[model samples]
Target chain A: MSFVSLRNVTKAFGDNVVLRDVDLQVDEHNVVCLIGASGSGKSTLLRCLNLLEVVDRGEIEVDGQTITNGQVDVNALRRKIGIVFQAYNLFPHMTVIDNVTLAPTKVRRVSKADARDRAKDLLERIGLAEKADEFPDRLSGGQQQRVAIARALAMEPKLMLLDEITSALDPQLVAEVLTLVRELAETGMTMIIATHEMSFAREVANKVCFLDEGVISEEGPPEQIFSAPQQPRTREFLARVLAAGRL
Target chain B: MHEVLQKFFSPHAFRVSLPDVWTGFQLNLKLMVIAEVLVLVLALAIAVVRGLPGRGATPLRALAIVYTDVFRGTPLILVAFLVGFGLPGLNIKGLSTLSNFTYGVIALTLVYTAYVTEVYRAGIESVHPSQRMAARSLGLSYWQAMRYVVIPQAVRRVIPPLLNDFVGLQKDTALVTVIGVAESVQQAQQFSQNNFNFTSYVVAAVFFILLTIPLARFTDHLIRIRERRERAQLT
Candidate 1:
């Protein structure tokens, strides 16, 4: 079975349909980058993976464990899946170490010493050991996002979901977050990232999925998806993204 | 007139007996403490009940609304009278009851809990839905979210307003005088009546101003700090 699968996933809000009949899969030990225009359901799809936004109808399975039917204990399901958002969403009142340590202590039942040690290790790995004592609001956007990554890593999640983590940062700050993501990719973390960073997607992702109107327009190795996309819509979308020159 | 002048200019002019003042002050302090503690607990209960999502919320909310409105909208004098006097007539047999002092505290809690409930609600709602989602997604149940994440932030945000409510409640303890609770204001009045002078009234005014001004200024200072931290985050 695929490590992560979304089968016939559909999401709607009132009269607006955001996603429909979406089927996708991510194998273990691979990075899958989802790229699309704004409001093309990219972020919504990532949210569904972790069940942050409940799907109207569908099944989402991570590590062959189904969570979308609402049968699974959401906290248990979420413990194995980590999510980082564009806004960083770090608890402003908490220090970087505390933000990273909270889930491990609460969900995993780790001792305070162990949680603190692990948080410190992750902060060091992210080049943010100096920030461990600082509250999130005191950190730069780049540093805050790195702390967010560490916070997610503290849960020891098997799957990490990235929803435009760098889009909210300054242009110079974007590279630092992307570089950290690149390091995660190199370490064989199974990740599904929804992003507009075409260059990073082209470099790190083993596979790329181009979503349009809540359906995968094309899916293939990064070479085929980026260089010679099969779908005209994918090409047009990439053309616009390239012209924007953010990559 | 010379004797009056002598009384005014004597070193004993402002001499308040510590034992006597302490007795009245202790009672006043006790009443304020009791009323503040009860108000916080009752407000928390009412807020939780109002926050619940069921048929229970309706009646609890109604009760909370009526409790707050009747106490806050009308004078505390009326509520203290109704609780201390009016309830005695019903005299439901075998129901052990509260004393005038106890009823006064209850009355203060009932009135101010509603006011503080709104403060808590505003604080709780000010927390972005994302914060709750983050906490829940991190494996906290709803109650756990409130305990570990939401309530702490809400309480922090509501502190200044909650303190203001508390100070207001402290001052309102004087209203219990109608029920014959000898708190500071009542004691001061009695002292003045016995002495046939306004010295006791001036003393009470001095005591109140001394208590409230510093607290008001301190809360204002805290609010400014919170705002400064928020503004610093933006930059």
Candidate 2:
């Protein structure tokens, strides 16, 4: 069985359909990149997978267990899946170390000393050990985004969902955030990333899914999806992306 | 101007009444301390109940809304009268009788809590929704997220406004005098009536001004520091 699977998922907000009968699968350690224009359901899809947005109809199975049921413990389910947003929603009131350690100590019930040690280690790995004592507002956008990633990592989640994590950064800062994602992927962390950065998707994603207007129009190995897409919609989207010099 | 100043600040009148007003001033300080603590605790509780999400909390939210509305709409003097007199009038078992001082504290707490509840709710809402999202995504439950992440930040932003309300509350403690609580204003009234001079009233006003000016300045100091910190973040 696939490590993660969604069967005929559908979601809507009033009359606006954000995901319609979408089916997807991800094996263990697979890096899947979702590529689409704004309002094309990429972010919504990731949100649904994390149960941030409940599906109006469908079944989601993680590690062969059905997690879409209302009876599932959402907080426990969320602990196994970490999600990072575009806005880099670091707790502005907390120092970098506190932001990273809060979940471990509060939610996971780790001892304070152990959580601190693990938070420090994660910050060091992200090249931000010197910033542990500084508040998030004092950090640059790139640094804040990295701290957000470290904060997510402190949970030691099995699957990581990154929703346009670099879209809010300056062009120069985007590369630094993406580099950390690449390192995470290399270390065998399973991730589902929604992105506008096509080249980075091609380089890092094992599979690429192109979504158009609440549906996955085409999906394949990154090479096939980027170089030679099968579907007309995928081709047109890529053409526009290429015309914009983004490919 | 000299004649007017002499009437308001007559040295003989001020000196003669100082001890009487001082005795009442102590009562004012005590009432303020007790009432302020109760207001903080009760206002926060009301705000949190009103803010609770989901269908299960609808009744609680409605109750909180009605409470703030009714209490805040009524003139405080009337509320004080209602609690100080009405409760004793009701003559219910076990609650029919209490010290006038206790009744005075209850009255002030009820009225100020309504105002403070609104202040706290504004502060709680001012915290960006993204902060809650971040906390929940890390597996914290809704109440847990609010307790650790939202309230602390919200409380920080609301400190200056909360202090503003506190100053208002401190001054309002004089209102309890209508219930025969014998605070500074009541003492001033007695002196003015007995001595046929209004200078004692000035002494009472001076006491209030002395109490509030430092708090007002402290609020300004906090605001300046917050503004400076935000500006530092921008550059």
Who wins the DockQ comparison?
A: 2
The true-structure Cα RMSD of candidate 1 reads 2.8
In each prediction, how many residue pairs overlap at the backbone (N, C-alpha, C within less than 3 A)?
A: 0, 0
Cα lDDT tens digits for candidate 1, A56-135: 99888889888877788888888888889898889977888999998898878999999999999999999999989998
Q: Report the CAPRI category for model 2.
A: high
Where does candidate 2 chain A have its weakest 10-residue lDDT segment? A63-72
Interface DockQ per candidate: 0.64, 0.85
lDDT of 2 by residue, A1-247 (tens): 7889989999999999998889999999999999988999999998888788899999999877798888788899889899999999999888999999999999999999999999999999999999999998889899999999999999999999999999999999999899999999999999999999999999999999999999988999999999899999899999999999988
Over B1-235, each residue of candidate 2 has an lDDT whose tens digit, in order, gives 7776667788999999888898998888988899999999999999999999999999999999999999999988998899888888998976668877788889889999999999999999999998898899999999889999999998899999999998998899899888888889999999989978888889989999999999999999999999998898777
